[model samples]
Target chain A: MSTRFRPTTLTGHELELREQVRRFVAEEFPAGEYLPGLGINAEASPEFSRKLARQGWLGMVVPAEYGGPGRTAVERFVVVEELLVAGAPISAHWVGDRQTAPALLKFGSEEQKRRFLPAIIGGEAWFCLGMSEPGSGSDLASVRTSAVRTDGGWVLNGQKIWTSGAHYADFVVTLCRTAPLDGVKHAGLSQLIVDLRSPGIEVRPIMMLNGFHHFNEVFFTDVFVPDEMVLGAVGDGWHQVTSELAYERSGPDRFLTSFPLLRIFLALRARRAVGAEAEHRIGRLVARYWVLRQMSLSVARSLDAGEVPAVEAALVKDMGTTFEQQVVDVVRELADAEQRPGGDLFDRLLAEATITTPTFTLRGGTNEVLRQVAAKSLLRGAGRAA
Target chain B: MSEEIELLEQTLDALFARHCGPAERTAAAQGLLPERLWARLVETGLTDLGAPDSGAGLPELVAVAMAVGRAAAPVPLAEASGLASWLLGATGLDPADGLLGCATTHPDDDLRLVGGEPAAPVVRGVLTRVPWGAAAGHVVALARSDRGPVVVLLPAATQVERGANLADEPRDTLRYADVTAVAAAPAPVDAAAVLRRGALLRAAATAGAAGRVLELALAYAGAREQFGRPIATFQAVQHHLVVMAEEVAAVDLAVRVAALAGPDTEALAVAAAKVAAGTAAAEVTRRGHQVFGAIGATIEHPLHHYSKRLWSWQDEFGTDRQWSGVIGRAAVGAGADALWPTVSAPLDPAPEAALR
Candidate 1:
């Protein structure tokens, strides 16, 4: 049997990058500055994102010629981890930096790259995904958003639900069916770089459980996306979107959403002499977190080497989001702090985490869907070997 | 792996395949050691691969332990090669040509040194659940001396009452009234350090067994039919198999980190590895049995071999709960501000100074 799953240790450079990111977060986005458990969709300030871009953090994996720092995926992972742990508001530039830039680099035309890459790297543009429609949550292949071919462009008409940050995004990389659905369900679909400010488009707020307006229902009625704005080839939306899921699924964001609460709990627990039970509970959580981090880092390394690692990415997401929710469960069980909505930091963070915990396994492809994806791939591989 | 280690692994694999087959394992499980296989392993220098002079490190020993685990070979690879040889070489004893074992299982075993009167010390008290205590040529154990905790090597001629763990390996109880030591020296590490080493070895073995069980479950799911279709086609069985795979993968990475960790981080790394591996062993074995249904529970099926060993090994060094306590205490002690840094610090490979 091939030893494909051998463990990996970080290099000196990756360690250095991690330390640098940690120091940056501490100095710039200190613990008390922001509320905890804001989730990854917390509204971020453009100024903060620009500051990160100045530090050569944003667009880390994009090539230098495209106005990026040209770092490896592991380096990007270090930055993302530190930001998440610090509870930094990264939503402003998250989608554009994390997935949009990479997608543009891979499948975008030269004009599209020249037009969008620099703005994304400069933290001036925010991108929200337009994949999930009103009727197509996990069944993304059934997306009914149509893009009828016009003289100079495609007229988009459909409704996209759960579009995170659509209100603040400058553009949405909308997935639409461009041709008749007479062939394979995945074919004849295309990705269009639809400008969010175009005519005949409306963004309606969908408040979260915490009364946060981070999610939206975006409607596109005859929104004209020019041919120059198309991402990749027409009729290749399925492949392009699936390729981007690796980035969406294998990030530190999936697991670090509730990390701020954990940090507060640990700090509070340290002041008092908690008994062995608390210690054991805290320790198990930390150990599990460490394992998850290592596993996520391994996926990053694979991505750095330009391997898709779709199954591995799905595995990380499935395990990671569950661990993220577990962090909330553990803190709630152990913390003696009050659970009032507007009490001390511990209570407030605990409340936020309680509200946000349910979404951890729901977003970025529900855990059930991801498990099926991973299972099929793994069984197929095993069957071939057998 | 280095060229030499890879060659050694290939050699060991070939050796196990030739001599340590199902019949041999069954015999070993029936209260008998495969003497010929053990002799071959020792003579081939595979058992002493962890000696300082052997130019192999813990990573190499981990590889050997994993191989030993995959075959369920009834040898003291972990105890002898991993812990004993390192201890012997550290305390200035000859590590050559001895099947060594250690008695450091329980914390309350009151083994102490007495009466050598300016010469070597004599060991007393009882050490329970000592791995390979009856079969080993010598046993290295921690005993309280007038100075402090000293390590004493006792010959296997001491009185030993044979015991067995879940997997039927020799976990004997040794009673030493006045067993004279062949060699006595200061312990290179504390009892906790010794336990961590043993835990690391067991984690590696567990990972190997977990990997094997995952392969078994996968193959079985593909073949077994339910409702006139392969059970593997069902989402439920596939989910179980994937979870098993995830556990195996986590254990594999955790073991590597623990094995290669520096002295400063070794304790935390090992504790994490043990917890993850122990937990994984339980889940993987349970799911493996679930996938195989009743056949996996029967002794006739080979699946029970790996699953039983996993069940026994998870509790041998330290259960998940026990190690979780160790890790939890350490993290809480470090406090919130320092926890991330403490866990994410780059590993130092420097050997630790002798434990105080």
Candidate 2:
């Protein structure tokens, strides 16, 4: 009955953009330039981010008036999907390009956008999220981070953990409580763009299981965020952060994180006479990947059309991350390459993917949390129908 | 959808509601032909929607097939209107006047066209699992001839042992001893192509059935109470319903995109869609039953009407294993370097346009 589920066909311009992005990746990410499966954050390269900025790939959805390409969501999806499948080093500008820019465009004051948008598009300003604190990972509304109103700014005192790229980021859009909790836990929360280089702020690297220093435990001791840096409105952090999560959850990165490894596994299988069972298994994975891409593209199209398909975006992330993890498992089974340290390319990539597989569903909102979001949306729909 | 399609959908909805109710469907499942309903359907020109060489676009056929599936109509509308008519048209034969069915076997199946050359081929051996074989007046099938794959129209008057699938729809096995063809023509496409078409139709039907099951599950979840509250309020039940909804959504998109793909990519698209639909059908039906609890499992409930059809249709043209194998081989054969290109190729409008 609802046309929301209808499949979308790529327009000629979108197809052309896909080819251009593919060519850009091919030329830029020549084999061996970047290792696969390092996860998005661990693969940071400032130089590569600048190259994308030069090519107008970053901030694609930002309006041209703010020094962006002013592209549609589908066009942005084409570029991001190509970058992701190639396992390009997109971490340096990933957060700012993906969600921060979009959030700023949506809810930022003109002065804030003029100050932040150009730098973000130019790859000079990198952003890391601060929604999750020491105890509030999935339960974001229960964040204890406080920003006390002061003379000309807010004195921020909080700790944000699992903050990817915070050490390299120029700013952290921290979610802080501006007022004491009333009847509602979600109320009184505000988003303040904290300068990472500001006084009294400390960034400590948190090493991953593979010893990758992509995450940071950021602590703020009376750090000041000027009143001009507040995003959207005061007490609107819950809504603004949730909207940003939609952008974060529905991107090509969710599923394509392990695709490079899949491509390698497929290449390995192609070299030999694979058994029928192996072929079926690989084919099943490819089919699932293809369908997920289509679904994700549809969500992108919806976003471009100015619809907030939060539930649809959640579905994509839940299914896409699950598929991403499965790709790792399936590739491990298909290829006999040992995931050893400093081994062959196949072995190394597999090892990285194996270690990173645990985070595919954990990051960007755990799959369980996303499923609850989707289920609640469905129940709401059912209620509406009844 | 255009106003015409929307109006057509409403008309079909009313027609099914009036004639294809629970009792009528039950009686039809028991081998009684609803002659009046069949005549009414034929009078509506629904049977000729996929007439031989009609050059019908897949979207139109998919619309009709989905309606038939949603109604769980016991008639072989998909076989007659979608597959059989398209096959007949492919071979340049006039469309059959009445109900028509089709069969495409695995390469290892025993069915073959042994004699009489290409112009006048003769079918031999037994054709198994022919949809509506006992009920149809004519059957169009893809069989291996001396030259290659050929399309043959066999009259249903030949000896046949009637059978039924999980949905209790006819899946009769036909025993042919050099049965002469009423009309035979060289197939423009290979057996695999025909099989893919059938699989596409099945995927569309499965999507339709899956959609209905989601609706039913949601409605039931909203009404049925447990622990002093509606089950829909329960997180576990809500989760199951969401999973079903996601599967339905995926299957629906897969079928539509596959239908719109070009010929070069149609096989891969159809194969992918079939795998998605077949896999989703299993999960959606399982969850649908879970949501309805004991009532959904009982024969008296109409839920089985859709669930059983989904289960049967998923494995009819090809199971998940079969279609996934097709897709896998294609991907592997293309190798990794060419994988993205193979997937991202621009799709031609619709197959019927090129055929025309």
Candidate 3:
């Protein structure tokens, strides 16, 4: 294998995409227009979501065959990372554009692809994942959401908690236990695309610590789905869900969530003369962040190559999240020592980041689960089958 | 660019495991390990590793330093053989196999060249707590002067007396006190750069030790049952273990990148890597001890051996606070623009640097 890496820096195409995305964010949903409040749906709004669609930035990852740019994962990473770092009001279309679109393009039937992919690319459609029920959070194998065979499709009857954007999502990709495969608890599950407007389905918003309705407890009461809505073959839900997770976990989003605050921290730190000690602290932080970004991008390249780098993704997420929290901690300490403005943008950004950071280790997968996964992969070579 | 160095890493790993086990390390601490083992290391071409045309070079030096650190070998392999050999090589001196030490700070002038005392002295005053001093055949001291930092070689046999460094290592305090020594030919090597390299290699050793501690803690966590199941299954201990793993991963990456950084950026990388690895070492060792409960602190337990080494090595080349201050000064002086241009610079290399 060649030791030469694809340049450690971004190239022209990537830079162009970033600048375009940055301009779209600035012009369409400037911070003044929709500065996220400390609530559940801090940055989610329909108008803001559609604005992205109209500008053709939403389908940056969607293939041209699906009315999208059909760009490389690197390009997608470049754009979304910039948007996320800018703290754009992007929650409304984030999942749909980021992972769901890619997953559908990979696993969706041609018809399913034709139906949802274009809308997703056009930014007119939105999505949420129905993988985690209350009892089965990161332990997705234990999902009890059942889907019984019906005349048209499958009748889904189970509940999914922490379904982000379900309140506004047009469709949800639901994972259900279709048949009782006896060998392992994971083999029996299957994925079905569910329409949010279908009868017997309930979407009740759950107020998070941030006090936003960004996520909802989506209940399925014998919810009917057309036969065409079944994603892939029966008993493939585990495989599909794992694929989705690899996408969700590996991107720049894992590390760049605190980027807005990073900018603010840099600006504020520069205003005062940082002594040797503080400079060292900040430099070390930046160095760590840079290395983590490189590692995360390596994983992204792996994903683009169609490899399931589950363990690598887990490692990145674990390291990236903790480092982000560390950055928050360091910045807070620096802020206190410097006695900088408490009400300034930097302070607000820091506070906002702090509130969101707890989820860093908990969200995608808890740190404990991630470590177990990491050890098994390194020691036992887990995920070899997939 | 350096495949030989990469291969040398495998060789050092094999050597360390063969010669520096717990018992051998303990024996070395007591000066009871067979003299032949050290002789064999020298005979195996490990001692002359940092010497140019000695078959092993910069890469081998790095690998050996890390390997010895990992083994927690009580020998001053890094200082005696690694740093001393490096400083000697820099001055175009033949660094023979045996004990050697290097000091960045030394006081003395106009004392030594050939016989009793020549026009200029090599090293003066004394460098206290010089690692590997007790056993080194020679100690190389670099004194900052108006010209630059002049490299001076002080043989352990003639001028230096030994002082205990406390741990089992061969550290010693030396008294140069107007001692006479040869000027030794000046070779083109930056003392600061060599020191930074040594610091980075030291951090690598600390990282290896920290990784072992984490592995031990993880294994213990797996089997040491608490209320019902193994404590590894417990969220609290598991979380801490994961945190340790994260630190290990971070330091591991930092060290590797710093190792590969170019001359211009090497110092910065070394400073950053030291801060990370040093901080990780202190924290991970403490947590590893915590997981072992009271047993880890007892002298009977081998865990202390690794932890003590970690504590000592973190303060050897550079402390966490010291490195942090270095980084902080650079960041502040560079301002926000150059502070982290690799990350913050508009995704494009600054055009001016491109022209070059």
Candidate 4:
């Protein structure tokens, strides 16, 4: 939105961390382990995630005071990008480590941070988000999840669908309306951390088009969460959640999922030394990837310097999603591997990428939402100048 | 590297904003601008700035020419004037008196400069089409020789024939019948090398035009309504607009980087820039028309002007495909590891541009 470009080069620390991630990914989940037809392992294997913990990558951005490595956000970005590039099964810990841990560190109570973050940093705990409801798609304020004050803390009653990793996560961070104020939908909303093992919690797996259990319908019928688990002050959910969306949105993870397929396409074509047509396509894709990487890295640097690059983050997501879809489409075109074609690794990856491409725009807040965010930020920046 | 460069860019941009904005461009749709504009620009000392610094020098003119190109003005300011100014200084010819057009032929000897006179010494040859040939004062033609390719500054009056082309700019066959000429000192340059610099300048201009067009299309999509909602609300349209933005950004960066890559590799960079900008021009224009519907393609609309220039500028230097092959071969030749630095190094030197 700013038309302001940022340099895109990895720092020495980030490059070193990237090498470590690459080595880990190569050894643990090599290309050989990536069977095309089989869907990705639905749950992030605790053992493998703990392996990440050993490498001090699980909470790269969390502060050392909270038992994290206290590396900058850029380092975390490098780690997540490499993990997604390798198709690592991070679905189990992705949300908790990347989003919830950072958000809690920023706004959670000292007690709450002490209790949940150490385990998160160790990859021993996992969490899922409970924001979307039956009728609330990308509109966060439309959430009907209601949390009424009760004896112990608050009782949450709602049904959240399309909640990723809810079945395997230890706890669920939810946004609920605390006070039913008329005509003010966004106010009186609060975020609560509910244990997935609580009474009156139901997690039903929703198998997707590719036969992967990546989502669930999480129901909370009078599920009680202690007041201490509330992320921020009451009625401050909008500010808190919006701030966290920046982290959830901007990253290499958003676009690099299909990179493995790109590698396979390149390898297959490398046998013929990549003809002009394929080379042209790969060049264009790589160029776009390079630009997106710069923008995302800029946002990371902004965050590292303690600046809130909300609009820049939105721009990254908006462009990043398109790049991901483009990569998938190009891979499909290059491989010409149909969904149900003869058993082959190329076909399987294509099948997964095609089914997964739609979500690129839908996830991390829809592109429309991001555009609005960008437009508003643009107007705000213009106003300040004016 | 110097504040003077920034001031020069700002000055040229201001000049463009005052003289070559959409309104002025529309006014020039029928013919080139009045002589007053040219006289005024020359008065700014831009016309003579590119001549060698030793003799009324203008080495700094390339940057200024870049700014002029960025404006997409309907003039051979960059080609006829910019190149002429540089060549005049390089060849010890003063061009302050009037405009001079610099043109060149392919390395192939299709148009032979033999015997002083002939019955039909029609120089039936083509140079990469110059931008403002319809209005050039003189056409300088260069041909490959046993020594090298030397550019002959032929007066526009010496043309034997001329014709129209798809881009709407005038092109001609400048017949050279044994015209008396004094040998300009020094052997001809690598015409291809110099032509690349010219192409790079055009690519920068194309990039500027493409950026403006995409901006207009995006704003229209955001504010314009279809099916009872802003078209920007439509995911299909949003995706299209974003792709346009991506291409424009790529062209913008490539052209700027190429401009800094010096003369030899500038062709490849320029080719990459041209291909990207040209492709973006087509895509964004079509998408603009799609979003705006029938009204956008009409003569009454301003979008056509941008698209016209896009087409003209694209074919002027080289087709997008030609440049693609040029860039591709350079890339393949450079190999993988070194290729990144080769393409990306120019970008590293400009810390301010990178931050900007």
Candidate 5:
């Protein structure tokens, strides 16, 4: 708010990385041919993830020493945006590469990093977040999930809901209360890397309204999480988790979910002599995408500079998600185009988006909750006194 | 940035802050000029930011223009001389063409440039809603001629249809059957650039005004108690403040980034800035009013000053519909495949020399 971005251009490496991703995407996912999924909820293809890994595109921020390509956040931004708008099937590594890799890099033990970072970037491993539970949604610190010390490990007993892809995930980075409460609600919290194949665990499908099974209810009863599986120090889960909120909130994914929808909408209307109304519609969406992407990239650049612009990131998520969701609203009205899809490409995607756009806000911290966070930060910045 | 640029920003901010308070706002609602404000600004010699080697650049000019907009200062045109300076530079006209009121967006049908006594070129026609032209020493208008688009600098000594925008800001309509242009440049001049620059400045000003409104909403929400606590404690009210801040941030970045990316201001950046600014202004003003409630609906409050200007300025240069058509058509022409590339085209690499 106080200063503008350092007026500058992308590095040659960043530009080159962008081109590489474009070329890789062109060959793998031909435009207008394949069924482009909505942003991250697209296809879960390990084969495609491995193919991306071959191009040195997966776990892009992972250091080469960890058997991963160490790239800057801006470079990752360049690559992710192209793939997202293309609607590449990246669900296999979406959470792992976006949230997990950085989490491991920051708080994972060396042994854990060595064990998982290689497989993560190599597209051989998958993970799911166990943050949300039926009892605890936005008030995450109020989680009732408990991990009691037992023998050489901790016995976890909790039910995590809306756990996307846990049935297929190899592991779940579960957050559990590790110690008895000590007044502070955030205290006694810890993150445990729980193996999904452990006994006494049940993954129940929580189908989306569209009858899709991207979500699930995972019940862990006395599931053992070894001491080594702990991410960061005990009682430090609050700090670690909150530290990553900025990353999760302010990414191309936040704004580009409905980007593919906009692309398809424009493609259908572009060649036609679309009336001024249609053109105006296209213009509004494109202009929004341009600026929102700019805002998202600014967050990425700040991250690369080792700055945690949490407020800016919240601004991005609140604004970015709202913008992307509106694209769905805009495109929903255009389902009956003078020219649409191969039979019903635009129709199918619009249908998928109409059902899924609700999650665009709810999934990554509800926009209502986000607005409170942003408002408080802004008020503080304004030095508002009551 | 250099220390001087920092100083310039502070100086201009303080200059506007000192005068554009309740008193000036009250006088403005009565349709009075902010004479003291304008007089002080002119005395600072920062009015003509386009002056060659003025030790300031587009960044400084933009900052000042944004301050002007934020203050809702009831001043005339030349507060930010970017478009004027742009015309002077584009047409190779003398820098001596003082206080130019740009009249580009208006229809140039009746306006034509013709050979007169060789001392002064003949310009005839109408220029409507030219931002505060009555205050400018000269009016630079885009005119049509046999060669192509001509930009003529006419002295603003003639009578105009003195107009007032919703905010009571001056918007004079220049009507001339045959006016002598002290300076004229033809064909090679850029009319589109003039319009885009106007759009860019309007966008910048709107952004600033919206920013001020957001501040107002935040302050009010934090102070006004409702249901035994500050209204800011309410989730619903917080939602409004957050959305307003989001829109303000987006537009603030849009215009600042666009202007700082200079030279290409004629291209997509300016258009994008206008669209983003216009769109965000809609959201900001609506949410701001909602937060202010009945008090905001009244004219005595200062909220209307910013909101009215935002409404009027957004309609100027080109509107969301008009500019969106321009952009949407361009995107269409470029094809869907080229859409992302065009939208994501990067800023120029800023070398140290360009860091002012």
Candidate 6:
């Protein structure tokens, strides 16, 4: 309700950590040598993931007892922002380090944390969210992925569409309908950690707009999940999943997708005398990016300070995603990729961005829905301050 | 916020609540300068905070300007103390002249410098769009001379052509014809520096006004009912409020960070903030009008005071194209290698702002 985003500056230590990531990028993926990516939907390199984890940059928020270094959210933000701006291939460990480890720390049992957190921080484990089924994308409470109680575990049966990297994932923290629909739509649901290697599970590939296999139709049938695999409590799945929204919705990933392309555009512009249009384009894009980083970092710092910035996070995510897509449009318009069929990295990234931008808004939450999410929260907190 | 700023804000809030309203704005628009409200605010000595000897800097001026913008109080709080005193100091003007005001020179002003005696230099030009020119005790402007830029300070008794912006704020013009200058000298600062400072002040003000507009929209939507419920409950209205909130947050962050950045990038930072504020002024006012509907569009409502001020201030310092173009050129000049470093440049937090 308060439209204030408390400004956050990186501490000296956090800035040092940022330099470390920059040094790593310089060593591993030097400029003009690596293929830049669009946001987190870049190349999936397990080798790169392991290298980052060895640097203690993975599962940053996971407490030390569970193998992570227990760094502050802002520190993780510092590292991830550098990697994202550099367009590092973080896809393989992106979901696990970003979502799964936090889920384990918050809701995973001691046994589950010991088993999963170590693998996650080591970058040996990968995760795919099972909240979205064929019928439940934004309306996650309507998930039809049912789980029946068995002797020692639950039997899962349903299909999750648009599950990014399910084929590459080692486990899935799935949203399952554990009980009958007893009048209330949000009740009777539970989160079950299902192993992708379990029997009666199929990770069928779904080609994306960019002709990449980033998504999958993950079908589950009679998949047995032990009682220990249950996340939180039955009928608490809705709350548990919604709790992840802040972390998932607002992060460096929301805005840094097309940054590398902007870098490329700048590089090219430097070689020539850019006209007024290009200058305005580059200037406005950089302006938006700068403010978006501040906004995103504010949310991260607020989370670190134990604030539930649901509205703030939604504001950042929605605005950040839209700004990123606009980044693509600016670069494309300025680059004139249509005429330069086989141009340089600028053209190539522009092609990828033009195609992949639709997914940028689609991936976490569509712009339209996120706007409403933020608006509803705003209205709810009406008259708090004038 | 630091205690000083917090107290200043609280004081301003209470003062505005008590004295600044429809009557004050109406009186000022009709040429009275809102004497009672001005008297109350001046009692706080905020304008003196901008005096050169006071050591108050951009942060202070920005704070007061934003607050003035929010209250829609028609006063020379920022201009008289901030820009006027900050720039005219090297002109050897006596500080005893009281709350000096500065005006930006325009090409249309056709400013010229004919030769004059060393004791009394003459400025021959028409200073255009001088904010609070008619009300300012002493008006100062910058003109081009053979040596370099010249700072010309005009006494309050100088002749003036009164004008007004859309919000009905005074923007009087002053004409000179080999006129004796109260004080004039080779400028200690360039036109670019003056424009940058002015743009930043305007941006801060625009940010403040936009914030108030959002609050008003939110307050209105929460109270106004249609279709059996508060319009805020309607998804359509909520959408407008959310988008306005985004613009307000973005603009506010831009202005604050620009104010925080070190001298190295202050120009680009100010330019970027001005550009963002310009864009926000449009977006917030448009979405704001939609949320308020007819009531917001009325002359009786206070919304117009902020919206009209936003509209006027946005074009004052520099248009969006002018500022954004400067930013664009800077980025290209720095080259691609410095792109991220430039965009993600860390703020060199000012001492007073260290509390943040």
For each candidate in the order shown, give its overall lDDT on alpha carbons.
0.81, 0.80, 0.67, 0.65, 0.78, 0.80
> Could you tell me how far off, in angstroms, the CA of residue B260 lies in candidate 2 after the best superposition?
0.3
Task: State the lDDT of candidate 3 residue by residue for A226-250, as single tens digits.
Answer: 8899888789878777776767776
What is the per-residue lDDT of model 5 for residues B199-318, given as tens digits with 9 covering 90 to 100? Answer: 878887887889889888888888788789988889988888887877777777777677666463336777878998887789888999999999998978889989999998887888
lDDT tens digits, residues A1-386, model 4?
A: 23443344464555667777777877886564464221123246878788888899887778878888888887887777667666677776788888888888888999989999898988888898888888998788988989999886998999998888887889898988888968888788899999999999999999887677888999899888888878889889878888787787777776665666665555443432256765566655554554456567767877777777676677677777777788878767766534563456666666667777787788657887667656545434433443
- What is the C-alpha lDDT profile of model 5 across A5-62, one tens digit per residue? 3333466667877888888888977888877878878878888888888888889999
Question: 2 or 3: which has the higher TM-score?
Answer: 2
User: Can you list the residue pairs that collide in candidate 5?
Assistant: none
Worst 10 residues of 1 chain B by lDDT: B347-356
RMSD of each: 3.1, 2.7, 5.5, 5.7, 2.7, 2.4
- Model 6 per-residue lDDT tens digits across residues B219-273: 8888888888988878777778888898888888777777677777687778888
**Share of reference contacts kept by candidate 1:** 0.58
Residue B123, model 5, lDDT: 76
Number of the top candidate by DockQ? 6
> Candidate order by lDDT, highest to lowest?
1, 6, 2, 5, 3, 4
Docking class of 5: medium
Give per-residue CA lDDT, model 6, range A1-386, as digits (tens).
Answer: 26667666776777788888889888887888776877788989899999998999999998877777999888888888889888889999998988888888888888999999999889889998887877788777889989998999899999998888888889988988999998898889999999999999998999986789988898998999999999888778988888888899889999999899888777764543389877777778877888888888888878887888888888888888888899888777776636353567776777788888888888875677788778777766665554
lDDT (tens digit, per residue) of candidate 2 on A215-306: 99999999988999999999998988887666787788877788888777666545542878887887888788778887888788778767
* Worst ten in a row by lDDT for model 6 chain B: B347-356
Better of 4 and 6 by lDDT: 6
Q: Show model 1 residue runs off by greater than 4 Å.
A: A1-6, A37-39, A269-273, A336-338, B1-7, B96-98, B117-119, B349-356
Worst 10 residues of 3 chain A by lDDT: A1-10
DockQ for the candidates, in order: 0.47, 0.50, 0.21, 0.15, 0.51, 0.59
Candidate 4: pairs in clash: A5-B356, B49-B58, B50-B58, B51-B58, B52-B57, B53-B57, B116-B178
